[model samples]
Target: MSGRLSATVVQQCVVSLGDVRTRIDVSIKRRFLADQDRVYPGLECPVPNDDTVELLSSVIDLYGLTREVLLLEIPSYPRLEGATVPDSGGSNSGQDQDQTDGHPFAVLSEFRERMAK
Candidate 1:
């Protein structure tokens, strides 16, 4: 099967937690074999070296395939256009302080103090 997929999806921005709209257009080409074992006799389950090849079943799950393809195409970390997260430069704010407290050097310093005591 060969076709084109076009979709528009709204994803949350990883940094700002804002809505990020994305347009996806993908070209798909695939070949499915009737019998997988016949293709590779000795192998328990032969994985196709080429991504476009696969084993065919009685039913072709086009919906599942489309979903999987769309998911892979979608950005894992979506960022809205012109949306930026300000960096907290070691401020005494609660969240920043909590993050800094988890630093590796901070743990080492605490360990050293405990050892000294």
Candidate 2:
């Protein structure tokens, strides 16, 4: 089967904390095979196609599939229009205080480093 998904989403800029308009377009393709009662000796491993799926149930989970595809298409990090992001900056780089002491895994990290040496 073939289908299309189109949506407009407002995303935030990770660096400048500004709004960004994003458009999502996803093309869906899927194939369902017949019931396999038995598996014979195959020539090498029988790898299913990326677009192929087994139709075991009578109903297809369209909502679940669409949600998964949307999650993949959405950007994890977004940038604002004309906003300059500092290369060396991190989440708390703009703050004056040292953040190393407050990190949750600092002790674990130190232990790991000592083990590495």
lDDT top scorer: 1
- Candidate 2 local lDDT, 1-117, one digit each (tens): 668889877888998888888899989776765445433344354547664475555687889777877888888988877888665664445452265647866557667888999
Question: Model 1: which ten-residue window has the lowest total lDDT?
Answer: 87-96
C-alpha lDDT of all candidate models, in order: 0.82, 0.71
RMSD (Cα, Å) for all candidates, in order, is 5.4, 8.4
**Taking the candidates one at a time, how many backbone clashes does each contain?**
0, 0
In the range 14-92, model 1's lDDT, one tens digit per residue, is 9899999999999988898768567667778756599888779889999988888999999999998888778665434
- Displacement of the residue 21 alpha carbon in candidate 1, Å: 0.8
Q: Which stretches of candidate 1 lie over 4 Å from their true place?
A: 36-48, 89-103, 107-117
